[model samples]
Target chain A: MQGSQFRLEHGKKVRLANMDPNETGSLHDREEAEPNIERLKERLEALQNMLYAEKKQSVLFVIQGMDCSGKDGVVKRALGGLHPQGFQVHSFRTPTEEEEAHDFLWRAHRIVPAKGMIGAFIRSYYEDVLITRTHKWISEAEVKKRLKHINRFEKLLESSGVKIVKIFLHISKDFQLAKLRNRLTDETKRWKFDKNDLVERESWSAYEEAYEDVFKQCSTESAPWYVVPANHRWYRDLAVLQIAVDALESMRLAYPASDPELDQLLEQLQE
Target chain B: MQGSQFRLEHGKKVRLANMDPNETGSLHDREEAEPNIERLKERLEALQNMLYAEKKQSVLFVIQGMDCSGKDGVVKRALGGLHPQGFQVHSFRTPTEEEEAHDFLWRAHRIVPAKGMIGAFIRSYYEDVLITRTHKWISEAEVKKRLKHINRFEKLLESSGVKIVKIFLHISKDFQLAKLRNRLTDETKRWKFDKNDLVERESWSAYEEAYEDVFKQCSTESAPWYVVPANHRWYRDLAVLQIAVDALESMRLAYPASDPELDQLLEQLQE
Candidate 1:
């Protein structure tokens, strides 16, 4: 998923969520939910230390997907091992009157991670393209301008030493329908099912087209996007974890040495 | 800290991090820094399921303290368990021109957790009282207004079913000086020591007085402050853990029932 000019086979499915070409297993197949928890813990812990040690580079994860495509669940599981202090998650909403006065990226620009931190945007600046293009919330010309602005914004972040990882959780509309039904049937969950989600689902095709364009235009070499098949929750979690671990491992960070070395300090502290 | 009159004593050094005050032994008395990982895992797992099941009443842990007082460490330790998906941590900065244009609470209001999630505000609305008051960033009259606003804000959150747990990590200025000195001396840690921290340290007394006044006024029957003595990291972590567990234990939340009524439906799915 990393690097430039990687060829992903284009599928006929208009819906981005349903475009996964993999067809070997059912949702409940053994490989679908398999996780090596012990290995993951070691990898996550080591990388977290490296991040703390390097203390100069940052990682930003951007999550975008259809409702119930498992964006929330993926975020929860993938970064669950990291220290909360080292990470922050920001979810964007409709711009307020004040936010309207500035460029769309202003709010997000300020929230970008500082050196050595990890920041995640649940639904981010990409909304300017997805929501705007689908709803005609802004001008078509403005949308094009935003696509350019996003590429530049991400490049700027990379230049400033922030590693950007973007994930688009892809799930079938049938899965979404099931989740929506579950939300409606489960009294405890009914509050989470916003009426707008239903309204948005009706415009699924429009959103799919918007998102497809968004990926093509905004997936820069500095910050690439991974389209993860998310009809199965476990698979979605595993894919996100793999991406995070991969990025951190590539950095090869290690715990900082103590003055006179950690051996001496550990002995002293122990005494 | 519970009940009508708010009768937790005014002095004699209290640590909110101590989950059970009557359980003896100061945190510094411990010989090792090892967490009771087994107990933590169990409790965390249970808390996770509770959060997943209730999925309505969100939790907000708000941290306020002097620089080097261990707010970040406390936050890290308390939330060590639990999946990060259901959780979020937001660290506030100086408001942008856009944010400054609105009422003080506008940015914060938008970020409050939806039902069934957890959020931590590292430096929250309380800054309007602590930092702004000491720095004279806002006028004295404005500080007074903010104190009232904070009380109302917290009360509103409580009424709206957001659990607000406020922790004021209390460490003596001398302890902070030692920590700051260590940071300055260590090459790896030198970057952690900001010049502004030193500037803020100089106004320690003024900040303390401002905090004292804010605590007295805004520490209500609903969202009381927990002043944890944090000179010892082990004790600080334990104290915060206890407070978090206490907050959850008191909430009267239970796992969603897979009721007998739904049993037949669930059994059919299993078959």
Candidate 2:
């Protein structure tokens, strides 16, 4: 599916209740989606190889999702085929002392992928506006100010060859409950369960409202946000893969033009 | 096939002439070594997953080699299976003006893998001692001084729980000629033919001597150097993969001990 179908329209009001998290378009099940998943994964890798060779534009995947929404899973399943040398994923948690000392974007700005690489931010500076606003830790005015900062920060990145693809993994509240229960019961996955997630779950509606505002204010024409369906894991992976492939394919990546002197140099080496 | 056999012995004088760049041990051809290469690549992915979950120590693979020595190729073939989120590769080229203003180790120090990640440095701070010394850009005494600085710098990193695996892709002069010719003649690879590679080829012996001194002076037991034969690309890939897997395996990685609080949380969730 084209990401534009789900992309947040600029200046349009967003209501989380209106969007269906379980919708999978024309596709039905994991089995049916498997072929396209494999094809897109291969295409993603081929495009990444060209991006690495071209060394001109970089791609950033900003993925944000609530508890048990499969943020990390989508990256591993959809984008994992990428060569490690040219791809990096960054997960922002509670800021370190040094990071907290600076503006919210400082930590992220320092490690934005250099030209020729792809970087994924599992949860990024968006958290500053999300959790802070949802928890009432920061005043609503402060949230507005930060959103403005975010739009500007993204524009700055876009102007300089960073193609930002912001993604919000949309999952129903019931789906989250199932995922959380499974994590708690599975012996191997119990380590991943946190009581704090339960506390965060209480603020789900607040989080949704905050995200809607972000989509309306921060999702610009140059750097739009995709609200991907995450209730169905298979569909989620395929959609994210298509979004990633489309993002790179639009960059028009190519290997550097062969140097004119190479012919003369080739003759010298032959001798 | 053990890395120890090729490891530079600390506190011993080194001679590049004695080691065989074309050595493949018992392996005869690419087909014969394919099984081990596949096995090791799979093993590497498993180990890296543990390292990411364990989130304690980081691994740094410092790769150094002459022109056409396959530094980039080795990472693509041997370590490419890694999850890009936890793996990063850095290729140090001519230092930027800002990087040159700081100490040689400054740039490398800032980007060492955070705990739980793996990083590969294509060319690193060692270049300060190498290219500068070989071309007489700096005095011999200055090179000696930089070598001392590098040893201490590595020790500092080792103490901070960074497992360092230094590798030298040892390929012969003749082998490089063949690789360079291939690049020049291949339309797709012609962009990789750097004229400076020809310039650096003239100082091959000087470069070897500089590297030998580095191996003798900087190869600490905590972070020893492996001189892997690279004339055969298949053997090179397998050996590097084995070294990488062994490094992570030795770290005793494990999932965070299931938090005792998680059991109570699980009980509460079930209610």
Q: Candidate 2 on B147-210: residue-level lDDT in tens?
A: 9998999888888889999999999999999999999888657767788888899999999999
Clashing pairs in 2: none
Q: Which ranges in model 2 have alpha carbons more than 4 Å from their true place?
A: A26-35, A185-188, B13-15, B29-32
Error of 2 at A37 (Å): 3.3
Best-fitting candidate, scored by TM-score? 2
Give the best candidate by DockQ.
2
Docking quality of model 2: it rates as medium
Interface RMSD of each candidate, angstroms, one decimal: 7.3, 2.2
Error of 2 at B13 (Å): 4.2
Q: How would you encode candidate 2's per-residue C-alpha lDDT over A1-271 as one tens digit per residue?
A: 7767778887777998789999999999999999999999889988887887788899999999998988988888888888767888998989999998999999999889889899999999999999999998899999989999999998888888999999999999989988998987776466667788989999989999999999999888878989999999999999999888888988998888887778788888899
* lDDT by residue (tens digit), candidate 1, B127-241: 8778888988889998888888887888888888888877877777777877877775666465455657867888977887887787678666566677765677766666666
CA shift at A233, candidate 1, in angstroms? 1.5
